[model samples]
Each structure stands twice: as structure tokens, then as C-alpha cells.
Target: MPARLPYAYKYLRAKKKFPHVWCPGCGIGIVMGSIIRAIDSLGWDLDDILMVSGIGCTSRMPVYVDFNTLHTTHGRALAFGTGAKMANPKLKVLAVMGDGDSMAIGGNHIIHASRRNMDITAIIVNNNNYGMTGGQFSPTTPQGAKTSTTPYGMIEPDFDICKLTEAAGANFVARGDVYHVIELDGMIKKALSGSGFRVVEALAPCPTNFGRANRQGDAVNMMELLKDNTINIAQASKLSKEKTEGKTVRGIFVDRDEIGYLERYEELCDRVLSEVKK
Candidate 1:
């Protein structure tokens, strides 16, 4: 059936059984497809992979994939992933989180984990507002944007995810929206192959809740917003915030070659062994 679906389609099949819980036209599916394709491209063992997620609509991703996943509490996926990596040291841990999950409640863990440069890949689905939580204004929601919590218009500032992660010491940081499917796939693949802490913030859409609440309408309209409102780093640098208007910065923002957290720990262990032997 369907020509046995190629070996490269391993991760894509899960969508069939799970169907799509996200609203039609929502970009979470697109982002998920890109992630699976990336994993397939890397030829990583499904058995050796662990997909951990925190609370939210995006966090539900790990459940649909056919990998060992831990759907943990809100904002705790990174911590759990860190422990898992430290224990096994062989498992390829991927933490799937939401904007609020990683930037708000879990912000501390994110920065500390980045500082430690753990051998883990973190994929953050940033749909601006909290889709699962009644379209509330999240840490990344643009200033003056309407949300459940800020119906009159938000007055607070937003966190540029890429810059924040890079400054916090993440070895690798990248940003890709659902609109850029190929780029998303490549970034995810690179992050997984990387040695130290990696973060990929995927700008997704919440057409049903956030879209309607913010007057952005259905999924198609939301996608159009992404197309019109996102900017690349090169483009962003040339333009001022006023010129960018409603646009956001997209694309890979940082990448560093450094010793992974576990690798360094192993080195420490080896040194202890050598000293004892002497």
C-alpha cells in the first residue's frame, strides 16, 4: 500500500495512526514532519533516541512519534533530558518544548542547561501565544499584540529566542518557522549531529485558539502572517525595529564547536581513574 512508503518515511507514518489533533492548516504537523525527516536523514537509531517533551500542544509531539519518549510536567523536559543523558551517556536525547515551557516556567533550566553545554538537542515550538492555555500572552508574544491575557494589547517586550539561547551559552542555536520546511529539517539534523547543547526554535501556528483570539483568523491566514512577518538574520541586521514592523527574525542564529557535557564528564572520570592508578 502506497508503495511501502520508503525507508526515509519512517517518522512520517506515525501521523497516519495519530491523525492530526492540531487544527487544519496548523504548522505543527509541518514542523513535526520536518523533524522526522531530519532524524531519518541522519539515520539515527529509533531505539537509541529519546524524545522528551514538556506541557502544551507542541509538547504532545513526543507521544505521536515511535520513539522512547517521556511526556513530563510543564517546563521540566530539559531537566529530565539532562538526567537521562547523564545516566545513559549513549542515548540521543531530544527535548521538544513550547515557548512558555522553555522560556517562561522552564527558563532557568534552559539557561543552566545551555551553560553546561549538555549533549542534547532542544526543539522549541514557538507559536507566540500559549495555544493550549487559552491563547495567553507568552514570553515571546510581540509587544502590543492581543492575547487572552492582554486583550487590550500587550505592553510587555518579547524575548528574541535565538539571542537569548546564544547568550546563555548554548553551543548551537537555530530558528526556523514552519513555513521553511527544508530549513527546519536541516537545522534539526545538524542539531542532533552536534556535540553540545543545541536549541532550535520552530515558529509554529495555533490557528484555532491563538489565531482566532488575536483576530488572525484560520490557519491559512496565520500562515500568511508568518510569510509576511518573518525576517532572516541578514535582513534583520540591515533594518531597524521600526522598519521591520510586525516581522520577526528567522534562520540559524548561532552554532559553536565545543566539547559536549557528557564528553567532558567522561574525561573527568578518566582523569580520576588515571590518578588512582598512579
Candidate 2:
């Protein structure tokens, strides 16, 4: 038998939850494993963590994890996560969303959440297209990339999720791909260990739809592409522009110290009570 991972089993549902609905070689499972390992490495209590997700392939994460899970409507993961964080203030809300779920219909929600510095972690698994909904082009689909809806080729530029979240005032922002499991785990763990609106964009491969549409070959081909095309932030800094051109840069982009939404809310409440008593 393969060596058992106690940490993984401690937080994940039993083997009865097997036969997940993702494609045979989909990278969402890698992302999920990274998440599970991150949570385990952090030694966090399962009761204190609230894993929330919107409708999509990545959204199915909550169904498998043994946490306080909320499988919400499409494009509303961050919205619901914000409310949950506000209501309890103690729960560690981790919103797992797809690119389409985060940037397409729910674009404004992430922006406002970061603006408010909400103490929640957004794990965005970006597969370039809508995997579950027939491989529609998402906001993160690369310009000139092909998708089910973009048969001729996508005409618009993709949103650099790290830059967008960083500019929007998230205390932590980072990018990781499924091919680099260790870095992805570190990014997620570091994001979870902090306050403010943290965001980790995990670029994964949607082999079934995205690959077939774009002629990206099989799962191995896509994963190999990720390995060859991505460069770490540290490594990228030392390389010249010509050397780094067209590479998908990965690593922690922003990690700033800022007070979270709940902290501000608590302060306001305390101040109001003090004024009333006085």
C-alpha cells in the first residue's frame, strides 16, 4: 500500500468520498492536496476554519474537506465569506473560487473585500476557462487563447490576479501553479497565517476542456508547459526582461501589514460603547 498521510486524512473526509468529479488528470486535485497539506502544516483546528466556495470545478473543494464548509452560489464565494467573517470574526474563512467565479461575475466582490481588508483567504484556482460550464472563456484567459466560446481566439487581455489583488489592497497576494506543489503550499500557508484580505492564485490545468480546445495536448503536456513557462519571483528579479519575457511569474507578490476588517469593526464597537458610557 502507498504510505498514508496522517495529516491529510486528519482534515480530509474519509475514503468514502473518493471518485471525485474532476477529470482524470485535472490539476484541481493537486491544488486541493496543496490546500490540505497547508492546513495540516499550520496545525490549525478544523473547527475554526470555514472553507467556502462558489460554483465551479474548484468550488467542489468544500465538499471534500472536513471543515466548516459552505458551497455557495456561482460567483458569490467572496461575498458569502465576507459576511461569515463579519458575523463570527473568529472563523478563518477560506474562499476557494475559480477564475470565472472570481473575476467574471464576482469581480467587484474581491475588489471590495480587499478594499475593506477583510480577514479571509481567497484561493483562486485559475484554469483560464470555465471548466465545468462547457469551457467558456474566463476573464483570466490569455489574450489570443482559444476556448469553447472563443473558438476564433480570445480577443481580450487576461487579468494578472496577483497585481489586481495587490493593488486592491490585499495584505497578502501571491501566484502559484499546480505543477509547483511545494511553492503553492507555502503560498497558501503563509496567506492563512496572516490577517487582512489574502489572495493566492493557483494556476491549474483544465485538461478536458481547455487542453482539447487549445490543442495543449494531454495533462502531462500542460503540466510540463507550466514547469517550463513559469519562473519564481526571486529568480525572475535576477533575470533580464528578455530572459523572463512571456514567463508566468510566480511567488509572493505582496505581503503588507495592515489591520483587518474585524479589527476595525471591533475598534468601532468599543469606541461607540465607550462614548455612550461617558
Candidate 3:
């Protein structure tokens, strides 16, 4: 008989959901495993966690996990997650989104969430295209890349999600790649443990769509490219700008304590109640 699955396997839904719908060589499955590993390492009870997602290939992750899951509308996962966080401050809310789902249509919501410093975690799996609907160029699609919407080549510059989140006042912000599962797992764990708004941008590959359209080879080739094009933040600091040009810098960009939205709201309520008593 084959060896049993790891303890984390218990967290998955029934065996019927086994063999996920993701295409062969897609990095989404790897990212999902990293999330499960992160949650397991933290030792948090499943009941205390809520997995939320919007409509996209990556957003489908919540359906496979056995946590309190919410599959919200397109580009509205963070909005729903914010409401859930406010309703129960103690709940550990995690919003999983695709590059298009979070950075394109939901851009406003994500930035506002960061500005508010709400205690919630968002994991953005950036595959550079709208993998679910079609191979359409997303906000994070690199310049000069080809997609269904950009057959001539993408002219718009990509948004650096980690920097965007950091600038918006997120308490924790980091970047990781599917090619580096160990590091990705660590970043997720750290994000989960953090307070206030946290965002972990995971660079993944849409082999079926983006890869084929761009002629980026197969999934393995795409992953190798990701590994080659990335540098850790610490190492990047020592390199000259010219040397690091066009490379993805992966690592924690921001981590600091701040008063979260829920705490501030509760404090305000308490103060008002005391003034009324006076």
C-alpha cells in the first residue's frame, strides 16, 4: 500500500473533490499546498479560520479546503472578508484571490482594506493573466507579454502588489513564488500570525493560458523562468539597479505593528459609552 497522506490532508474536503480541476502543470495546486502547510504549522483550529475567495482559478481554492469558506462574487472577496472581520474580530479571515480578481477589478477594495489596516490576510496568486475566464491580460501582466486581450503585446506596466500594499499602510507585506514552496510557506505563516492588514503576493504560472500565449514553454519551463527572474530582497539591496532591472524581488517588504480597525472601532465605542455615563 502507498504511504498515507500528511496530517494536513485531513483538512481537505471529501475525497470526491480529489483530483482538482486545475490543468496539468498548473502552479495553483502547489500554492494551495503551501497554504495548507502554513495553516497546519500555525496550529490554529479549523473553526477559528475562514477562507474567502473571489471568482477566479485561484479563488476556487476555498472550495477544496474544509474551513469556513466563502466563495464571493468576482473581485469582491476582500470586501466580504472585511465585513466578516468586523462582525467577529476574533476570526482569522484569509482572502485568496487571483491577479485579476484582486488587482484589477478589486483594486479599490484592496487598497482601502490596506489603508484601514483591517486584521485580515490576502494571498494574491499572480499568474499574469485571467486564467479562469480566458488568457486575458491582468493588471499584473508584465510589459510586452502576450495574452488574449493583448495579442499584439501588453503595453501597460504591471503593478507591484507588494509595494502597493506596503504604501497603502499594510502591517505585513511579502512576495513569494510558486517555484519556491518552502519560502512561500514561511511567508504565509508569518502573514497569518501578523496583525492588521497583511498581503502575500504569490507569483504563480498559468501554464495553460499565459504560457501558451506567450510561448513561455510548459509549466516547468515557466517555473524555471520565475526562479531565474527573482531575487530575495536582501540580496537585491546589494545589487545595482541596472543589475536587478526586470527582476522580481521576493521577500518581506513591510512588517510592523499598528492599531487594527476592529480595535480602534471598539475603543471608540467604549469611549462614547463612558462619556454617556458621565
lDDT of 3 at 213: 98
Write down the TM-score of every candidate. Answer: 0.92, 0.97, 0.96
User: lDDT per prediction?
Assistant: 0.86, 0.92, 0.92
* lDDT by residue for model 3 (1-278), tens: 44887786778998688778798988888888998999998998999999999999999999899999999999999899999989888889999999999999999999999999988999999999999887899999989999999989999999989889999999999999999899999999999997899999999889899999989899889999999999999999999999999898999989989988888999999999999999
Candidate 2 runs further than 4 Å off: 1-5
Output the lDDT of residue 216, model 1: 91
- Candidate 1 positional error at 136, Å: 1.2
Query: Which of candidates 1 and 2 is the stronger one according to lDDT?
Result: 2
Q: Model 3 lDDT vs. the true structure?
A: 0.92
Predicted candidate 1 versus true structure: per-residue lDDT over 154-213, tens digit per residue? 899999888888998999999888887787898898888888999999998888767777
Any idea how many clashes model 2 has?
Answer: 0
- Which pairs clash inside model 2? none
Query: Cα deviation in Å at residue 70, candidate 1?
Result: 0.7
The true-structure Cα RMSD of candidate 2 reads 1.5
Ranking by lDDT: 2, 3, 1
